[model samples]
Structure formats: structure tokens, C-alpha cells
Target: MPSIDLTINTDLARRILTGFIRSEIGRIGLKRAVVGLSGGVDSALSCFLAAEALGPENVLAVRMPYRTSSRESLEHAQMVIDATGVRSLTADITEMVEPYFARFPEMDKRRRGNMMARARMMVLYDQSAAFGGLVVGTSNKTEILLGYSTLYGDSAYAINPIGDLYKTQVWQLSEAVGVPEVIIKKAPTADLWAGQTDEQELGFSYREADRLLYLLVDRRYTPQECVAEGFNEAFVQAVVRRMRRNHFKRLMPPIAKLSNRTIGYDFLYLRDWGT
Candidate 1:
């Protein structure tokens, strides 16, 4: 395990998140944003940013809990709503996903979790349409790099403010944003299944996994180099393999390249394309 400090200064984090939302809202011409608050750090941070950028009136916090969700998670999510004063709604997705589970009771943990994520997303989108807002995502960079999220589930959103921050960095930002201390120190779990924690699902702590990820992706260290730097070879390989396998998930859907400048091909750039 690596002993690393992934903390960000309060001032710098506020600047980054505020800038991200301001830029994204302008780009999409959206005046409001809807966020799925799961009582997790990433969602808490994103909700705070949206509230800051769009004002509390324009930010809607939707809490979509399942039958298996903990009371602690529910309370923490409510705490965020109180802290930010964002318009909030609650939808219990247990009934929504019950039929699917009934059809596939033998489905594995991963599949069940994916279904839950997608169900929550569906609720978020519906609320977005009802409120004329965009769905603000909360997946952090560490999860994105390691493919820790499900496609079209937690991965799909109009804009993700914290997509560049690692999991540990998210903790720092959450604290700076005034997220409750209980949420900050709670065991990191997706609350997808009973007794399922994120680190347990990933087979490594975020501290160790995120450090290895920084060395490999941000620092451009090769496998041998990472192992040389005291990281376990097996863990390094696992992270690298996941990054490669899920490269497609990070990209826009592949185009047939019929036009001279296709969206996912040569034509796609973030630069201004004036009408």
C-alpha cells in the first residue's frame, strides 16, 4: 500500500469546481442541473458545485434509494440537501427495479448493481426533463480511469464536474465544500448491494489503487517502472488491463466515418465551431 496525500487546498478546489460548472453550463446553454445524490463524496461535491454555479434554486438534488440502501446513506444525502439548500426530491428505485430482479434472480452481483445504476439514471433523466435541467454526473477520474462505473449507468451525464479528481482528491474537495464529516469518513461503498464496499469490490484500497493509477496514467510509468517504485505487479497489471479494456467506454461511440469530418473521428475537437 502507498502512503500518499491526495489532498487539495480549499481555495484551489473551489476555483476548479466553480470554473468547471461555469464552463459546462455555458457550453450546454443550461440554466439548471439535476444531480443524483447517493450520499457519497463525489455526488456531494458535484451537488455543491452545481448549487454554486447555478444557484440553489436551479440545482435539484434527487435521492434515489433502493431497498438495500442504508439509513445512514439516506441521512447523509439529506444533510447535503440541507447544507446546500438545493431543491430536493426522493424516488425509491426498489419498486422500479423489482421486476427486473424477479426476471433474473440468478443474475450476479455486478449485473444487479449495473441495473440499479441505470435505474437511478433513468429517474435522474426524468427529473431533468421535468425540471428542464441537465443531469450532472459525479464519477471521479479514478473510477473513470479504472472503469469502475457501468456504461449508460453512472457513466452517462450531461457534464461531470469532478471527472478529473481522483477518489482521494474527491474527499479533500468534499471537506472543502463543507460536506458532512460522517459522509467524509464513512466506508466508501456504492451501496449497490448489501455489505458491498467499493474497495472490496475493486480488490484494493482507493489509497493504494489511486496512487498506482497516478503513477501509471498521470506520471506515465510503465508496468516494470511502477513495480520498481514499490507497487505490486499484480495490482499494476490489473489496473492497466482494466484501463485498456474499457478505453471504449471513455470515448464517444464509434462512427462509421462516412462524412469528411465525423463526430468521433477527425471532426471532433473541443474548440469553438461557430455556426
Candidate 2:
């Protein structure tokens, strides 16, 4: 059994993330970032880093709230706005999604949630054009690994500073960057509906998932090895299944190869490709 340390060097991680944000956005000659503030620590940390990298005036924090979204989520989003002094706006998604819901009353919660996620991205990209900034993503490494994000919804972004950090590590960096304590302690949610939480929906806490993921993915541990290390066999299987199943979400759309210089296959150099 290997000792797993989920803790990150927040100070160093913070520096690397801020530098990453600054360079990735600037690499394309863009000086601004448009982040969807969900009032969760993931988005909050991204916003903090964006504000630091590009200055608050250059970062636009957009709050897209569905009707069922809690008042606390909205307030906490405002907390990030105030704490970072980033330019901000709120785009209510109820009107945008309600018509579709009315048209298809048979849509289940998952369907509606997916719709809301895509709708939010539509809003974010539209605002991205007006703000002249790239969309900064909010999904952390844990959610990314678990396939916990909508395909082009929450997962869509021009650059992601904390995409490598786990959910627990997101908290550590959030505190180091001065995110609100209330936000740091709150139950994480996508706010797709009232009274919904991430852990409840995922069927396990991120603390547990992160530990297991560190072994399975980072340590390259076998599933049986994880069980031998005291993790429940079923839990190990579930996480392993998700990581394997969601592998497609981690990559670009596959292109069929007929030519020898197919994009993403052999023509991999992105440098000098016209910004």
C-alpha cells in the first residue's frame, strides 16, 4: 500500500496556475478572460486566478443562474466578484431554458440539467464575443476524470488553469487565493435545481474519490492493488469504470485518417499556425 498525499503546495500551485492563465490567454493575443461563476470553489478559484493574471478589469465574471438556483449561490458568486473586483454580469437562464422545457415536459432532471449546462455555455460564448475574452473553464480534475461535466457545457473553455487540481485541492488553492470561507465550506453543486448537491449526485464525497483517483490514475495502481490498499472493491471498480468510460471526453473529436498529414494525428505542431 502506497501512502497517498492529496495535499498540494498551494503557494507553488498558485504561482504556476496564475502563470499558466497569463500565458495561455496571452499566447493568442487575448488579454481578458470570461469565467462563469457558479458560486462553487472551482469557479471561484478560476476567477481569482484570472483576475490576478489579467487584472480584475480585464476579467469578466458572468453569473448564469437558472430559476431553481439558490439565492446563496448567487450571493456567494457576488462574494467572489467583490473579493476580486472583477467586472461582472448576471445572465438569468430561466427564460432561455423554459421554452424548451415547456415544449418537452417529459424531459427528466438529467436531460434538463444537461440543457441548462449547454444553455449556460451558449450564454458564456456569446458574452465571450462581446467581452473579447476567452472562456475560462471551472471544472476541476476530479469532475473531469469522473465525466461529471456536460460535453460542451461546463467542460468547454478556451483555457483551464486548475484543470489538473482535484476537488480537494481546489479547496486548498481556493483558500490560498482568498476565496470566501462560506464558499469554501459550502456543499458543491452545479445548481441545476434546488436542493441538489454534487456529492449526493455522484454517490461519494470528493475526498474519497480524490484519494482513490490518486492511486488509480496518478500512481497507475491496478484496481486489485487499490482494493488491497483498503479501498472497497466496489468503489475501486466504479471509479475505474468512470475513468475508462469517460476517456473520450478528455480529447478532441476523432478524425478519420486518409491523408498522411491528418490534423491531430501527425500534423501536431500548433506553433506558427496563425493565431
Candidate 3:
């Protein structure tokens, strides 16, 4: 609504991709990057960037699929590994998760989804330590803004190269970087719940949502201003409300200020480790 051109320069995009990887490496001293490849565009982009940043020898991709995961997903994941020449592992997590779901059959789908996300993170972190690598997050800015990711799950990461881009932008970058067509064209799904699509769950198209978010967040457009520019008032309000409400998830946990400079209170850093 606040006027998005949605145009990307192919040359500039290539530069941005390299720049993000370099910036992350400089900030975190990345030796390697570990990623959970769900056969999705975001993960594909992250893996591609990791391979580019630290070389394929330093990138490890793990595929953790539950019982309901699609076979095509695995195939697509294999394609990414082959294309990027990165080493990969397939750890079917059905055995790990089924037992918990059996105990709590009535667990909300969202809760189960969160568990799945967190389980993958746990596995990725362990792999990171075992291999002396960092966990690269796959979430984009649009999902982060909409609170669409699970806390400590897909949300937690050692480094995130694509966190600043929107959902639609993810596809563009994925294609530019030579991600598989199957993943790029497929419906965006967390693959947590069966038959669940991201657009369907969000109740809005990525184009519409990205536009409104750009206005409200990027352009600093007020709610009334967004509505006047042709965005639905209710939709704009919903997005802004969600962004404000979930601000905590995007930040380090709050620390009590008993001392002069409590951790995460007064001290802030662009580096991951404090020296």
C-alpha cells in the first residue's frame, strides 16, 4: 500500500547474496554452517549461502522428516545436496516424535508443529557441536514479522543470512542462486501439519501480506495511511498487532537490572560472543 515496486536487479541481487554471507561470517567467525533442509526455498537459500560462504566442505545439511512428510520433499533435499555438493544426512524424526504425540493425542496441531520445529533445532545444534559448525536459520523477515515461526525452533539460530528478506523475495533469491525448481514452485508449507500451506494458514497471499508489511514496517505508514493507500484496514491492523506482540521472540530474553550493566539490559553487541 505504501508503494512497493517489487523489482530486483539481477546483478545487485548476486552482490547482496555474497555480501550477506560475508557479513555473517565476519560477525560470527563461521567455521561451518549446519542447516535443516525441509526441501523448502528458505532452507535451500540458506544452504546455498552457507556453501558459498564457507565452501561445500564446511556446509552440512540435515533432513529431519516426520511420518507425514512427503517423499518428494526428501528427493528435493537430495537435489539440493547434489547441486551444492554439500554433505548431508537424513534423520527421519518420526520415531522421535511419534511417541510424544501418542502420549498426547489431543495436542494442538500448532503445539505439535512447535515440537517438530524445536526437535529439528535440537538435532541441528548437536550436529553443530559434533562438527564444530554453526546453526544457520532459514526463517525470512515476512515470517518473522508475522510471528509465523516457532520459538526456539526454526526461530533459534547461530546465524541467519536471509532474515531480512520477505517470503516472495526468498523465491527470487533461491532461483537466482540455482535452487531446484521443485522447491521453488511448491506451495510454501512448514510441513508440520498435514495438508497445511503457509498461505492457507496465514489467510492471505504472500504478495498482499508482503505489500502491507512493507508499508507498515518499512515505509513507516500509519494504519490509516495504509488503509488510504488501498490496504484493508483489518489486515493492516492484524499484521502490525502481530509484529508488536511477538517482538520478544525476535530478541534475546529480558534480563533483570539489579547490577549497573546486566546482561542483555545495558550491554548490546553486533558480535555473537562478548570479549
Measured by TM-score, the strongest candidate is 2
lDDT of 3 by residue, 1-275 (tens): 34496556645766776676666655665567788999889999899888887789988999999888877778888899999999899888888888999999999988898998888888899998987788888999899999888999999997788888888888888888899888999999888877889999888888888888887778888888988998887888888888889998888887778988878867766574552
| lDDT per residue as tens, model 1, 1-275 | 34455667878878877877777776766688999999988899899989988899999999999998988889999999999999999999999988989998899888988999999989999999999898999999999998889899999898888998998888888887788899889888899888889888889898888888887777777889889878888898888898999888898787787878777667655643541
- Give each model's whole-structure lDDT: 0.88, 0.92, 0.85
| True-structure Cα RMSD, model 2 | 1.3
User: Which should have the higher lDDT, number 1 or number 2?
Assistant: 2
Considering every candidate listed, which one attains the maximal lDDT? Answer: 2
Query: How badly does each model clash, as a count of residue pairs?
Result: 0, 0, 0
Which portions of model 1 miss their true places by more than 4 Å? 1-5, 269-275
Q: Which ten contiguous residues of candidate 3 have the minimum total lDDT?
A: 1-10
Q: Which ranking of candidates, highest lDDT first?
A: 2, 1, 3
List clashing residue pairs in candidate 3: none
In candidate 2, stretches whose alpha carbon ends up further than 4 angstroms from where it belongs are 271-275
TM-score of each: 0.93, 0.97, 0.93
